[model samples]
Target: MTAATDGTRVTIIGVGPGDNGFLTLKGKQAIEEADLVAGFQTVLNVVIPFAKNAELCPMAYRDQEEVLDYAVGQVKEGKSLVVCAWGDLNVSAKELLDRVRRRVDHVDLVPGISSVQIAMSRSGISLEDVVFITLHRRDGKESALEELVYYLKDGRRNIILLPSPYDLMPAGIAAGVIEDGVPGDHRMTVYQRLTHDDEQSWSGSVSECAAITTDFSDLSIMI
Candidate 1:
């Protein structure tokens, strides 16, 4: 395959919501063709089989800069690579890729089923009729609730991407909505570890959910 200047090319592959079955054919092909496969440990594990011949570089969310540096070094060495990501790479890897792109000129991205789509599908809700918001990268304690309230006030169904923050979880989201004038009886669902074999989902009213103190996984989704 052709490469950019200095021979570094990056292919960002969306591995889907923590399930190997969700990986697209194109994504798999990219992995098989790459010389390096890099991403979070969980995603790296899921894609390891396809990257049998490629070097695997595992990194955590906080290690994004380090991972990008390593990837750039490999690309400069003329290695073809595929970077795995949970859900759609564009969703969680936006900030990471944004920085990497400034260094690596040739980049390609393959889309996969995002957790947002899977949550909406499992809930049997039409995305066209819902308001979508993501607190995944934002400081939830800041404007997350305010923006949520604005949409919640519209009365349209909402599909929110919650961050793993103390005050923006399913319970906290419910409490915020209830305090924003929505009735406690409003219905919503919390989908945990979405799309995985052990995935679990809970449905309840806002008030009922507010009483829950059980912590959810980092992959949980609320709708």
Candidate 2:
């Protein structure tokens, strides 16, 4: 369904990594003004305080379509809707943005800070010297893994990667890169729960990371 022609708009706002403090001013204003807000429960929780005036619509992967459709219907009724996403929309949230765009004709995006930026600051890497790849999407991970390997082999730029939580996590990604001819001794750092109080980071050779058995948080990035 398309957005209502009476100027009602659906906005997709990035809530910024896991920390609400990182939320941008524009993003905060959008959420605060929304009539209906929808997002994964975790993301919604981060923006709950700012979305005080809106009806909360928490959704999971299995029911995201239904929830988004409901938000669109609300927009049709002349109410403003905001769909929250974790991190910056330009980074790992393209899939979510694509889904939102498919259901609404006029969707405004408000970008927020991404964990990748946090990782960069923590690792002292410049954005121009880094290539980012996220395996966080629902599908097409094999090619993403290949792209990671390809970049790793290039050896000119550092990589900031968001691995798939289900598989291809830090260890799996390290192993895959090593198997694909990137040196096992290449330095790698894994940052977990960035921008949060319990944030943790581990830095070691690719082989060491591949051998790691310790469970890492789902909110993790590798550099």
Q: What are the candidates' C-alpha RMSDs? A: 2.7, 2.3
How does residue 119 of candidate 1 score in lDDT?
Answer: 86
Model 2 per-residue lDDT tens digits across residues 1-223: 5435635468888899888999999999998888999999989989999988999999999999999899898998888899999888898788889888888767788989988888999989899999888889888888988888888888999998888886778888888888889999899899999987799999999999999988888999999
Output the worst ten-in-a-row residue range by lDDT, candidate 2: 1-10
Runs in model 1 with CA error above 4 Å? 1-7, 139-141, 165-167
Give the C-alpha lDDT of model 2.
0.88
Clashing pairs in model 1, backbone N/Cα/C closer than 3 A: none
Q: lDDT for each of the candidates? A: 0.79, 0.88
lDDT of candidate 2 at residue 207, scale 0 to 100: 98
> Using alpha carbons, what is the TM-score of model 2?
0.93
lDDT for each residue of candidate 1 in 1-223, tens digit (9 for 90 to 100): 5534534569888889978999999999999999889888987888998898998988886887888788779888878878888888656556656766777777788998788888888888887877767676634445766777777777766656565545467887787788879888877788998878889999889899989988977788877
